[model samples]
Target chain A: MYLAKIKVTYKPSVLDPQGEVIKSALHRLDYETVEQVIQGKYFEVRLSADSLAAANGLVESMTEALLINQNTETYNYTVEEVEA
Target chain B: MYLAKIKVTYKPSVLDPQGEVIKSALHRLDYETVEQVIQGKYFEVRLSADSLAAANGLVESMTEALLINQNTETYNYTVEEVEA
Candidate 1:
């Protein structure tokens, strides 16, 4: 089995309202050091694949399909082997 | 200034309770294909530093100090130059 970790984030040009809210909250909570806050989605999948290459192919297809919307967001992933 | 995108996620071995809740929610929403929903924090920092190396240094320090709890969570980052 293999483990795939994916991260999805909005494009830099887009405005992140969720992040803005969190930034304000942090400021209110006295976290003045926090200059900005951007929120993104994280996914960890346990693949049934036999090898790293297979796992990567599965993850890449998933990312390109329903996992992310390429129009407004971008994503990247890393894969590792799982020890049984 | 450089743009630093940092992603923080829980260690794979640890069970993610938040992800469980989201997974259940997705199932209820009829999104059965959604196998898991692990959530993580993302930060988009606009550094005051002049170069990518300096920005990386700042980001590393920030990650080590407060952005990530190394004991339970791990983080990775990518830096890019912002065109003027």
Candidate 2:
């Protein structure tokens, strides 16, 4: 088995309203030192594959096809082998 | 300056509807090898602090108080120094 840790976030140019809200809330809560906050989605995917290379390929394709909006969002992931 | 990468995830016993939905979608898309999907929130926080320890402390407190529900969710973070 392989466990893929993926993070999907808005592109730098995209506006992230949720992150903006959180930043303002933090500032109001006295965390004035907080300069910026970028909110994103995290996913842990466990799958069975023949090898590390196969696992990576599957994860990348799955993430691209189903997990993110290609225009406004981007993602990166790390895949690690794990015992089933 | 410091950059804190935080991940907030539900406790093992808690239900994750979004994850379940994604898992079903993946299976439908022919990713039958996928065994599980756990969804969570990710945050990139940039802040000004005196030291790495101070940054870590601030991030921990902020995350516990604002970013997660202690009753159902747990969080982990890594703080690293960054160019201002």
Candidate 3:
């Protein structure tokens, strides 16, 4: 088995409402030192592949087709082998 | 500065469309061993607080107000001190 860690984030230039809200919340909490707040996602996936090569190929296709919106978001992932 | 790593994910009972799509993609790529796929988000935030206590307070409020929708999702974060 292998563990795949996937991350998805909005394009930097795009405005993030969620981030803005967080920034405002920080300000209200007197954390004026925070200059910005950006929000994103993280996923840990368990794969049942027998080999690393096969697992990687699967994750690649998964990221390209579902985990990310190619036009607005970008994704990156890492795979680690787990001891059985 | 302190770094806050925030992770957001869907509630387990909820159906994750993105994850399902990714699962199909993996199948097409011949990774038939994958039984499930769950998608989520990751965020890295840099804070300019002078003390760790202040930074923690800020992140807490941020998570409650914007980083996560308490009703639909849950979030957790870690703060790390960085050298100047």
Candidate 4:
């Protein structure tokens, strides 16, 4: 089996209002040292694949096709082989 | 400076309906090899602190206090010191 850990985040140019709100909340809570916060989605996917290459391809395709909005968000993932 | 990469996920006993939906969607899309999917929240926090220990402590406290609900979710984070 292969386990893929994927993180989807906004492009640097994008304005993350939720992140901004969270940062403001932190500051209100007295975490004055906090400089920035970027909030994203994480997914753990377990799948059977013939090889690491196949696993990576599956994850890449799946993420790009369904998990993210190409115009507003981007994703990166790491696929690791695991015992089934 | 310190950067904290945090992942918040539901406890093992908790049911994740969103994950189930995603898994079903993937199956419909012909990702039949997919076995399981777990969806989660990821946060990247940048903060300034006096030392590495302080940074870790700050991340821990802020996460526990604001970012996660203790009843259903748990979080893990990696803290790295970065050039200021």
Q: How do the residues B1-84 of candidate 1 rate in per-residue lDDT, one tens digit apiece?
A: 577788788888877898787567556654454455576777776645656787787678766766678888988899887753
Q: List the residue pairs that clash in candidate 1.
A: none
Model 1: chain B TM-score relative to the native chain B: 0.90
Docking class of 2: high
Each model's DockQ score: 0.25, 0.94, 0.53, 0.93
Backbone clashes for every candidate come to 0, 0, 6, 0
Instruction: For candidate 4, write residues A1-84 as lDDT tens digits.
Output: 999999999999999988888899999999999999999999999999999999999999999888999999998899999999
**B37: Cα error in model 3, Å:** 2.0
Could you tell which candidate, 3 or 4, scores higher by DockQ?
Answer: 4
Q: Which of 1 and 2 is ahead in TM-score?
A: 2
Off by over 4 Å in 2: none
DockQ of 3: 0.53
lDDT by residue for model 2 (B1-84), tens: 999999999999999999999999999999999999999999999999999999999999999989999999988889999999
- Candidate 3, fnat value? 0.70
What RMSD, rounded to one decimal, does every model reach?
Answer: 5.4, 0.6, 3.4, 0.7
Give the number of the best model, judged by DockQ. Answer: 2
Q: Order the candidates by DockQ, highest first.
A: 2, 4, 3, 1
lDDT top scorer:
2
For each candidate in turn, the TM-score is: 0.57, 0.98, 0.71, 0.98
The lDDT values for all models are 0.72, 0.96, 0.76, 0.95
The best-first sequence of candidates by lDDT reads 2, 4, 3, 1
